[model samples]
Every structure is written in C-alpha cells, then in structure tokens.
Target chain A: MPFEEKFHLRIPGPTPVPLRVQHAMNRPMIGHRSAECSRLVQKCSQRLQSVFGTRENVLIIAGSGTSALEAAVANTVAPGEEAVVVVTGAFGDRFAKIADRFGARVHRLDIPWGEACSPDALKSFLLSRPRVKAVFLTHCETSTGVLNPVRDLAQIVREHSDALVIVDGVSSVGGVPCEMDAWGIDIFVTGSQKALMLPPGLAFVAVGPRARKVIRQAEAPRFYLDLQAYQEQLEKETTPFTPAIAHLFGLEAALDMLDEEGLENVFARHRLMMEMTRAGIRALGLPLLAEDAVASPTVTAVRGTETIDATALQKELRRIGVVVASGQQHLKGKIFRIGHMGYCDPLDVLTLLSATETALHRLGKPVRWGAAVAAAEEVWSRV
Target chain B: MPFEEKFHLRIPGPTPVPLRVQHAMNRPMIGHRSAECSRLVQKCSQRLQSVFGTRENVLIIAGSGTSALEAAVANTVAPGEEAVVVVTGAFGDRFAKIADRFGARVHRLDIPWGEACSPDALKSFLLSRPRVKAVFLTHCETSTGVLNPVRDLAQIVREHSDALVIVDGVSSVGGVPCEMDAWGIDIFVTGSQKALMLPPGLAFVAVGPRARKVIRQAEAPRFYLDLQAYQEQLEKETTPFTPAIAHLFGLEAALDMLDEEGLENVFARHRLMMEMTRAGIRALGLPLLAEDAVASPTVTAVRGTETIDATALQKELRRIGVVVASGQQHLKGKIFRIGHMGYCDPLDVLTLLSATETALHRLGKPVRWGAAVAAAEEVWSRV
Candidate 1:
C-alpha cells in the first residue's frame, strides 16, 4: 500500500489534510480571466482577512511559504538598508538569509537553539540602531519548537524605531492566536499547509499601511513577488499571473471549516493537544527541547537520550505506521518533533503517545508501557 | 452553479485537467521527508525528463510558470551582464522585464505581434554582440498564437556566439515537439497546467551543462527560486522548500496517461486539433491572428470583426456553457483565443467551433450554421 493511504502524518507543516479539503481539489478548472473566477478570488481574499485577524486584504501567492517570506523582505527593505533578524532556530536563520540575499544589511541577533528572543534585547538593539528599516521575527520556530513573543517584540520595535515588524507565522498562524493588527505587525506571512488544513502551494501575506508605504518606495529587484502588482490586481479580484486554482478551491473549503469551528476554539484545541503531548513525553522520561513557557502549540521537540537515536526512533515509529519529523540541520539525530497542529484532537494525541511508547519499548529503551498514553488521556479528559 | 463544474476552459493556460489527475489529488498527505515521498519525487523527476527530452533531471518548483521564468533569468545572468530577449507578445515582454529587474543590460529583439522571430535575425544580432551572456526565446507565444522556431534559433546561437539559448516552453512543450538535448537548448522551462494535464502550481525546468556552469558563477540575488540550492537538494531526491505534494500526485497520474498514449501520438493529436480549428475558422470567414505557417498547435487566436466584440462573444459563449479567452492587453476586444491543448481532442475542437458559430450568429455577425463544424469534421475524419 502507498504510505499516504496508511501512514499517520505528524510533520510540522504539510500536515494531514482533511477529507473535505482533499475532495475540494476535484473541482474542475475554470477560466482564470473569467468573471466567475474574479468573484471566487474576491470571496477568498475577504475570508482570509478574518483568519489573519486584520482589516487589510491578504496577498495570496501561488508559491510555498518561503516565497511569502521573501516577498515580505523584498517589498520592504531596499538594498543597503538595515534590518534586524532575530535568529532562534533554523527558520529564523532562513529569514535573515533571505534578507541578506536581497542586499539588505542584516543584523543577526542570535538566541540559543531552544530559547525565544528577549524583547528587552530587541529594544536595546533598536534604540542603538534607529535606522533599521525592518525587524524580522518568527512566531514559532519549527526547528526548536519555540514560540517567540512576537507581540512584545513588535511593541518594542514600534516604541524604539520606525522599522516595520515582519513576522514569519508559517508554523503558527491558524493554530496560535496571532492578532496581526493588535500585535502591531506590519507584515505577517503564513502558509496554507499548517493549521489551514490544505496542501503546500499557496502562501498568504497581510501587509499593513506602513509596509505598503515602504513597498512603494523600495527598489528591490522583483517580478513574480512584486506586492504592488498584486495590490493593483486585488482591486479587480484577480492575480497578475495564473494562480493555483485547485489549491484555491481547497482553501475555500478549508476556510469554511475554520470559520465553522470558530478561530478561538481552534486555538484552544491546539493548546490542549500541546499540553497533552508534553505531559505524555514527560511521563516517558523525555526532556522537551523548549521550556514550558516558550513551547509551541503547533509542534513539540523532544531531546534524545544517550541511548536513543532520533532517526532510529523515527524509523521505528514509521514501521508501526506513524510518521514524525526529525531534527533539521545541526540538530539532526539529537531531537525529534511531533506535530499536532491541523485537524488534530485529543484522540490523535493519545495515538501518537501510544505509538511512541511502543517504539521506545521495541527499541530496548526503558519505557513504561501505557504510561505515556495514560498521562496524555488524563490531560485530555480534564481539558 | 459554479463555473468549475460545467465551463469548457479554453484559456491559453490554467487548461482543463484530466479526471484521472484530479482524482489522484485526493490521495492523503504524507510526510514530505518520508521515504515514500522521496521515491515519489525521484520518479517524478525521471518521468519529467522523458517529456522534457533531456538526459538530466528536471527541477520542479512549487510556484507558477512566471516563477520558473524568473529562476531561469536569476540563475544565468548576473548584474551588469548582457542578455537578449525576443519579444513577440506579453509573455515575451515579461521575460525582458524580469531580466531588467535583475539588473541585466537587456537587448530587446522585438518581433511583430503575429509573426515568429526569424533565426537569421537572431544570428546577425548575436554576431554583432559576441559578449551577450544569454538569449531568451519563447517557444509558443500564447498571446498571438505564434510558435517560434526554437531549435533553429538555438542552432544559430551555438554556431555564431557562445550565448546560452533559453526557451520558455510554457504553452508548448508537451503538446509540441521540443527536444531539449537534440536542439542544444541550454534551458527549457514549462508549466504543469498547460500540457501536463495538472493544476497550476508546479513549474519544471530542464537545465543543460552550459547553463549549469553559468549558474554556479552568477551573482543575481535569489533565495526561493535559487537553482543552485535546488540542484543540491535534488541529490537527496527532495526540494529545498516544501513542494506542492498534491500536484505531484496528480503529475504522476498525468505522466502515466501521457506515457500510455505515447508522446508522438500526443503531438499528432495537438496538430490535428490545430488543423481542425483553423479550417473551421476559415469556413466561418474569420481571420486568424497568426499566419497559417506560424500558427501554434496549442492555442488558436481569431481576429474579431467590427460587428462582434471579443469580450461580448466570450460572455455569450459562457452563457451557452462554454468559456473562451479574449485577447490580452492591447489586443483585448480585438481578438479571441481558443485553447485545444492537453486533454483536448477532435470532438472538443468541433464543439468549440460550433459554439463560435452560434455566438457569432447570436451577435448578428454573418456566419454559416454547420459550415464551421463540417469543415472541422472533414479535417478530423481525415486525421
């Protein structure tokens, strides 16, 4: 059998899509320039505003999440302009690297792997470098499972400098409570595959007025990701180029599901899953990479013991029909991650903990059978 | 009812996807880093090579066709380098504009709207400018429905100068005969929605040795559409960023269908459709935008008479449960297009021509009923 039909996917992004969204992909193609297509695009853009928690329209691009991040950077900071990027993990480093590629003079503020960036440090940096044009932040870093304090960091940037606060909410947005306007975020970028319960194709970015002003004046070299062109086309309820029509269909269905469930309830469910998973891991005598206060609601990263190899654990779980993500880049084989972001419930968390317990026991590690699942169930029942 | 369920998509791109490919997209999401996902990606890359007519693997990006075009320019031409772009229509002008955005000193070789670029003109230009780093050509101009002689143009570039010949086969590749290795084309880019019988999210590019050499040394700013990172990740049978996994499933099914029918038969089918469409238009006393000798096999552009407005004709056709594309940019309301590529067949051509006749008659234009369909059926029966 194909792995897609049998394996339980628990990767951070590219999360398991719901059946309704998958079925939505079967909708036939439409003429993109037709009036019907324009109406469909217009409706999708309006619905996306609610999820983004912004009054402004979100710019949708037919690309991966990285392209959206690049667009946010390319549209705001011109070449030789200064920007501060807080690097807490691999994805934070990616944000900084993208800015660097666009000829921005990036100032890397490095935080430890499993820790979030301090807002006071950012304030001091902004106070010293008042000429910085933008401050890049990652709401949730998938590599270390750390949820940075974006609201506090954005507030500090607003108080100390005129820099735009750009947030990479790729792994967090729909799962966590990210109020873009309330947080003073000038540019917020997210992917469709995470808590959106869709496949990995379309990316969304909500640009505020300050970022729009910078976009008009920025001399960045861009064509496919030009925000001004997208803005102009948005008025006509279409994109400048052919978009992913099937993905847009799926987005409509997914957004309907999100709206039906209520955004606050969805966030609460994610928070419950995170607590249950962490409780289960602790009961299994495993240490989480991120501290409790900064742990991400989307994914949980657990550090491996001396006897446990992360890749081996992943493969062992795969044999038992569960799929999880391993550490990325420098942390490979040292940590493992379990994602419970989209379309996940209490029962799903119990299954993941049960599978981990079995895999650890089969690998000759000292694991108490049923302890992890029982602990998760206790947290679940209370929630 | 939604237009997706009933509309006959006759646009130049975002073409009609086959039922099998659409069904394939319903497959459940798998972990992108899993072994199964790796196998799927490797198989896709190999099958794409057969369609691209290249010995090397094709680079697949999770973006629109324009993103693939940007990658071609960003990888080969550095800032301050000289390049030549052949502009015959909107997409051609887009290619030149992207190079200019990347700071390349672009030499625009402007051809007439409805005419193909002559190889002799390109040869003379190349001889005069020996320092030209790259030459961009559009294989099929979807705007004017003209097909350029890319093989001959690449041969001239190889003989006269050391410039790399890059071809945009966006609307042509699978429906037309474009042998990348045999023609000495350095880079060939295409989209999934046109002839690949899939949705519009994925873009494919087949790179030759000469272009790879230049890409290694090119200093153009890029991160998401970076070819070097893609090349490195291709070794691991994966992409640098998350790809459109649902499209990959659809692509596998579509490629299987193409292989079952054979590529030669696919090209022959497109040719037959083109002949039938042209014969039908001529029988209805409609002039074609492109001359017969240079007409494209994928799409047909027809000039509208003063009695008939192109957009109104398109809207009238839509009311009768068919959808056709009107001319783009300055040609809007002057000409209309009919796309008969990918999953289209002889019967589809007959239906399109019949609808055109009905739309023209309803608009009070003098058109003979059944004459156009009979002309198309004559060509179809002969085929």
Candidate 2:
C-alpha cells in the first residue's frame, strides 16, 4: 500500500538510472581500505581524467554538484582573497554565494537570467579586481538553459590576471563539448546525475596544475569537502572517507555506456535532439527563453504565455506520464524546461512535444494537435 | 579491457544496495520544483521521521553521512561559539574537526578508541565548559566498532547544560534502538547506507524542537548544507536544491523493507548475528576490540595477534570471496572489522568466520580446522 504509486523521471537531472548502471550497483559490498577498492579507485579516476580531458588529479566526493563547487571554492580561495563570478543563472549565483561563504571577497558580474556572461564582461570584471585569484563560470546553467562561452572567458581571465578559471560543467559535459585542457580551465567539476545518466550521489572534480598549486596555499576551513585529502587518498586508489560505493559501481557502468556511444557521437546526438525539441516548441508558437545562439543544446526552455500556469501545466503533463521542469526564482511560472540530455533520443523529443501539445491545449493555450509532433518528426526523419 | 575485473562492497558504511532499492532508484526523474517532487519529498520526510522517532522535521541531503555531520556542525555552531565533542573513536574526532573548521571553540572529552564515552566524563566536560551550546557524540563508531551510550550522554548534556545533543546515528539507527524523543536527543542523523539497506547517496537529519530552535539562532555561512533552507523547503515536501531523487526512491524502498521486517525483530536478528560472530572469533583466538557492554551489534572489530598481518589476512579473505574491512588510521594492521548489518544473517556470519579462519591460517596465523565454524554453528544453534 505504501508504494502503490509509480513515477518516472523526465527531469533534466537525476535522470532515470540506466538498468546496466542499476545492475552494476547491485554487486556485493567491499571494504573501503582493501586493495581491491583502491584498484577500483585508480581505474575510476583514470576514466574520470579521460572524461575531463586532463592529466591532473580527479577527485570524487559524495555529494551533489554544489558540494563539489564548495570544495573548489574552499580549497582555492584563501582567507581575504578575492574572486570574480560571472552570474547568468541560478548555478552561477550559487557559485558566487559559495565563494562568499568561504570568506572570499566576491565581485559579481550579473547578466540576464536566461543569458550567459559575455567574455568582455568577464575581462573587465577581472581588470577591476586586479587581485582576484579565481574566476568562476558555469558551462551550462540548468535553471535557465544557457551555455556560456567558457573558452573565451578563460582566455579573458588569463589575459587580465593570474587568476585560475573554474567551471561548473554539471549539465553539459557528456551532452556537449567541453575540452578542459584546450580551454585552459583550471578546475572542472560536474555531478553524476546530469548528463552521465547515473544516479545522484557522486560529484567529480578535475584539477589542473594551477588549481593544485592554489589548493596547497588555501587555508579555508574544510574537512569532508577537502579536495587535497581526497587527492592524497586517490593516489592509493581510495577515498579519505567512506564514499557512496554503489554510485561508483553505477558510474563505472555509465562510463562504459558513454564509451560505447563515443563521447563525440553522444554530444552530436544530444545537439540534434535539442534541435528537434526546439523546432517542435517553435512550431507551436512558444518563444524560447534565450536567443537561439546562446541557448543550451541540452535543455530547451520555452517561454509560455501568461494565461497558462506553467506549474499546473507541468502537473497535468505528469498526470499524463510526462515530466518537465519549471523555472526557478524570477523566471518561475514564466517558462517550462524540457531536457534532451543523457539517454535521450529523437523519440524522446517527439514524445515530450506531443505531451506538451496536449497539455497546452488542455490549459487553453490553443496549440494545434500533431503540429509540434510533425515538426519533431521532420527532424527525426533527417537524423 | 579496462573493466575486465569486478568488485564487491563489504564495507560497513557503504554497504551493498539490494535489488529492490536499485529498482526503486530507477524510477523516472522528477523536477525538484514540481508538485510531484514535493509529494516525493513529503513522503520521504514522513517516513524518515517515523524511522527517527521524531515529529518535528526531517531533511535529506545528497551526500554521505560525513556531509550530513558537516552540515549539522555548520548549521548548529556559529563562529566563536563553544561546543563539546565526546571522542570515543575516529568519528568523534571527525566531529571535532568539522566544528573547528567552522571556527567553533571546541573542547574534547577523549576516550579510548574501542570504548564508549562515560556519562560522568561528559557531564564533567559540560560542567567545565558551561558556555557550550552543543555536545557531539556518535551512536555507533564504525571505525572501532563501539556503540556510545546515546541516552546516557543526552541525559548528561540536558542535565548539566542547555547544549544541544547531536548524535551521529549513521551506523546504528535502523539496526539498534534509537529513541530520539524519549532519550531527549535534539538532533539525530543517519546515512542511507549501512542498516538502511540502500546505496550511499542520501543522508537524513531529524531535528527536534530544541534543535530547530538552535538552528534558527546559529549562523555560519551555508547554502547547500543550510539546514534552515532544507527545513523551509521540506515543510512543503520540497527541497531547496536538486536532491538525489533516485537515491530517495531507493531509501523509500529500503525503509519499507525495514518496516516489513519490524524494528524490534530487526534489532534482535542483528544482536543474534553479532553474538554468533563474536563467539566464532573467540574460538579462533581473536580478541574483541571493545568490551561486551559497549560493543556494537552492527560491526565487530577483532584484534589480531602481533605476528598476524591484518592487511594480508584481509586480502587473502577477499581473494577467497569474503570481504572484511581493515582497521583505520592508527588501528590499521592491528584490527579487522566484520559487519553483520543489513541483509546479513546467521549463515553469513558462519561463512565469514569459516573463510576468515582459512585465510588467517594461510597467512601463517595457525588455527585448528573447523574450530571457528564449529563455534559459530554452536552459537547459531543456541540462538
């Protein structure tokens, strides 16, 4: 009687864990200090390094993406240090808040919620705060469906100061292109739940040479989120504390699945699916939250009409077996987000569009039946 | 070629996740802001409250048990505030470290690693630190396999001072008896792993009225670990940030499984299994880590002979398909841990003891054949 209800995950993150991943998690338990666990740690770390495109150490923590971000801030920013955070959406603001919490003097460069920070804005922000030790940016903000120009911002930070560049690539890594070494990114961190098609519980942090040096000098108060401690233990293929072992099992399977698809093919697939979703939404006469050029290729945010309640529409969609995410804070109720990342294909896009058409019509938004699906079908046919 | 090998988890904290929990985790993702997610949150919170014996509020975070402990410290202790930590083992030291990380003035009442904190010692410590606002203690220290007297410590803290009594019940809650309200415990927290029979990703914090009031007054920079924000969103069955949804699903199933087994029966089974393990170890000429009165029924630490290479013995057992944890930090190479919590039964204890005896003998630690198995069979028959 307690679990009679059934629900499905179509939201952007914590996506339905793949069956293979779930099976991987069902393996017997092992001791954390054993050589076998250390071997796993070594193998998993190598996979993560290859994924992040870095030769430096990769640290895994038992928390969401935000906790990894906190570790980055607490380890890079010393007391009385300063940093520049380019804020375009909720996650960017979150990074800035974390820096502030670590006692760093944060200089925020705020942009519109649905837009990304311009490279020029970041350059000027760094120039104004000449003593800044780090520049924080989000590769793809899930809340507003915006993808920033991370390479350009990193270049700007390099030109203006000796500050390290940190990126929150939570929702973009597996679904989009992010070459950490090529972009000169000092630190790249992500969560397992997003594009990795794994359950939420583990976070990945990829450190570069500069970030490593900064961490050695950082004096921020930290214990559980300590990247240095993790790095040390990882050298022996273990964690400083007992980690979410089942998550590691699931992640190993996820990485295998990603390899089977190939990273490049996965990125291309995600982009094409996003196009299909966008074409479907645009065909229905709904405005996209951000301009097409700056919109993320992982999630499409459709600006709904004022007459329709986005929350109610989401609920109605759920009733019909579709799950979508609503906007946050200022953008709440103004737009509905459809995710096209991790385990998604053209068929998924079509199903969501069809559901959206029905929910819109049910809410009196006056969308034509089959029109959105037709647009999606056209994209799928070409694929 | 990279994943040609397979691994298992026989650790105490990140125990093996059951298939039922894994299936629950495979549920579709839901939007954190959606009403449906709020329902999931509400349901998980209510069930969590029932398990913790609390009626006030329970919050979930996407981290290991350590992250929850750090959050409790960051949310309960302000800068320059004073607190007392009863150190019975490594976990107690971890609490002190977390408190110091947040700039709290900490006073430690240190006890031997394999012993419980004396109620009189805690009272004396509180009497000495009259300005203390919190007293930290561990319900079960997985490191040394010692179970602290939670009720005794809580009573001492309440009687001696107005300090909030926080218990890290990560390894004990479901396996042993934890009467939060009757014991006057202000805060009780546990992780999803261990006796919960779920994967490691979710942690629960159940706060009583007094703990909630302390959180309201306590201020340290927090965002992701902000208990206030979690409580606020949890009131409506929502989370302030994106939670580990799949992990929650797993937790819901695990809790249901626990309920089906019945708490009293589960506790009894665990005790019976522990007794069987101890009897087997004694037959093998192994010394128990803790005194019988304070030993944990969940995990038992066995002291090995000076000539016995505990690490090699652990490896040999693992190679033969049995996994047990080696001691941590200073205790490493001297002690080995055997866990009998969550899904473990009398048969498992016998099998483990048999395998351990063979492994030790192979590693030059002599023991008569069938001695351990015979001892364990006798205990199993008696029970």
Candidate 2 Cα errors over 4 Å, as ranges: A1-10, A306-316, A363-369, A380-383, B1-11, B306-309, B360-368
The TM-score leader among the candidates is: 1
The DockQ assigned to candidate 2 is 0.54
Candidate 2 local lDDT, B228-293, one digit each (tens): 888888876788767887788777898888889888888999898888888888998889999889
Q: Report residue B339 deviation for candidate 2 (angstroms).
A: 1.0
Clashes of each: 0, 11
Query: How many Å off is the CA of A353 in candidate 2?
Result: 2.2
Write down the lDDT of every candidate, Cα atoms only.
0.90, 0.83
Question: Which interface RMSD does candidate 2 score?
Answer: 2.6
Docking class of 1: high
Candidates 1 onward: DockQ, in order: 0.85, 0.54
